[model samples]
Target: MITAQNLTKRFGAHTAVDDVSFTIKPGQVTGFLGPNGAGKSTTMRMIMGLDRPTHGSTTVNGRPFGEHTDPMRQAGALLDAKAAHPGRRAADHLRLLAATNGIARSRVDDVLELTGIASVARRRIGGFSLGMHQRLGIAATMLGDPEVLIFDEPVNGLDPEGVHWVRGFAKARAAEGRTVFISSHLMSEMAQTADHIIVLGKGRVLADAPIAQFLGGAGQERTRVRVSDATVLGSILSADGVSITQTDAESLEIAGLPPAHIARRAALENLDLHELTPLNASLEEAYLALTDDATEYRSDRTAVAA
Candidate 1:
């Protein structure tokens, strides 16, 4: 398991990550999500010990990453695919990593097959496409055969098939009882791949909870009702503390009011209704509502800090 305790960092005067804390349980894929410049990469970098935190720390398997006996064998990470030497062959790069960590050379072939890049392992890194590079990076990470795997935006350039493959690979890693922590800026991808989600914005954690709890627990239980007579529904919903919005000419999106109240109101007023239905918010909707304020754009602010 991975645990972060008050992890924080400041670059000069600007704070990047502010006292963020969370747990990544084993046997599950936990997604890290945030908007652009929301300090996600900074936090991930701190976890990998690439940058020292200004305060607190994050631990993998109850110890700092740098302190591990075999850091690469204990935890493998791909902070950036472009960080590798461009002139080197894919297989040579993996071999160098394995040699540095004292990992067996045979594991190199295993990861090559695992990531589906063995066919192009002889090619130079400069000639690989984004998807191919992603695969090679995964191969490098898996060379250690680590118990903890951290992939940041692993599907950035992958096609639909490659995306599905990476998703399955993440689940397979967890099935082997490894701690799989994947980070991406895409909420849609996270919704499909993550068992739990950690939302961050403006150097702060907005929400950290299970996928079900986040979808079912965070937002209001609102219903979408469609009627032939939107005017009548609008008049009925104008009462105190009752919220309603006109979704279309013949439809109304109602919330903060129960379906029975709407039904009875329509019946008593002698109005004809076409449909009365509840519409629960999806993960995308919940995310937008939660991060509406944390968005980088603001009209009132004099200057944007980030």
Candidate 2:
């Protein structure tokens, strides 16, 4: 498991990571999410011992990452896909890492095959494509077969098949009781891959909870109601706190009310209901709502003349 207690980092006069505390337990995939400049990379760097925290502490498997005798064998991270030497052959690079970590050379081939980059293992890193680089980075990360896996944008340049494989791979690793923590801007993939989520904004954690709880808490529940007379049903549902929007001639989307309450009120009014479906907010919607004020950069949506 990985733990961070009051972790903080600062560069010169700017604080990148604030007093952050989180526990990434084993047997689960925890997704790290945030807008740009939210200090996610800084936190990950601290966890990997690449950057020293200005205050607080972080540990991997109960100790600081650098304190581990065999750090690679305890935790593996893919912070940057271009971390390897551009001139080295992929296989040779993995072999070198294995040698330094006292890992068997045969394990390099195993990871190469596992990441589906065995065919290009003998190729120079400089000639590899971005997708190939990501795969190679993942191969290097698995060379030690560490129990804790940290991947930052593992699917950045991957194709659909590669993305699917990575999603499944992360889930599989978590299923085996390994600590899997991933940071990505892909909300859809993260929604499917993560059991829990940690959202950071402006160097502070905004939300940390199970996927369902986070989604449910981010926005009000909405329901779609289809009736014979959309106008009449909308009028009937409108109240001080309730909001109703005419989605179509025959349907109304509602909020601030439950489906059962709507159904009962419709029954009391003897209005025939065709459909009353609850609209669960998507992960993207929830994320946007939660981080709407937290985003450091905002783009204008004004239309431009051709």
Count clashing residue pairs per candidate.
0, 0
Q: Residue 44 of candidate 1: its Cα lDDT? A: 84
Tell me model 1's lDDT, rounded to 2 decimals: 0.86
Residue 9 of model 1 has an lDDT of: 94
- Residue 143 error, candidate 2, Å: 1.2
Residue 65's lDDT in candidate 2? 98
User: Model 2: which ten-residue window has the lowest total lDDT?
Assistant: 297-306
Q: Candidate 1: misplaced stretches above 4 Å?
A: 224-253, 258-278, 297-306
Write the residue-wise lDDT of candidate 2 on 38-128 in tens digits: 9999999999999999999999999999999998899999999999899999999999999999999999989999999999988999999
| TM-score for all models, in order of appearance | 0.83, 0.94
TM-score of 1: 0.83
**What lDDT, from 0 to 1, does candidate 2 have?**
0.93
In candidate 2, stretches whose alpha carbon ends up further than 4 angstroms from where it belongs are: 271-274, 303-306
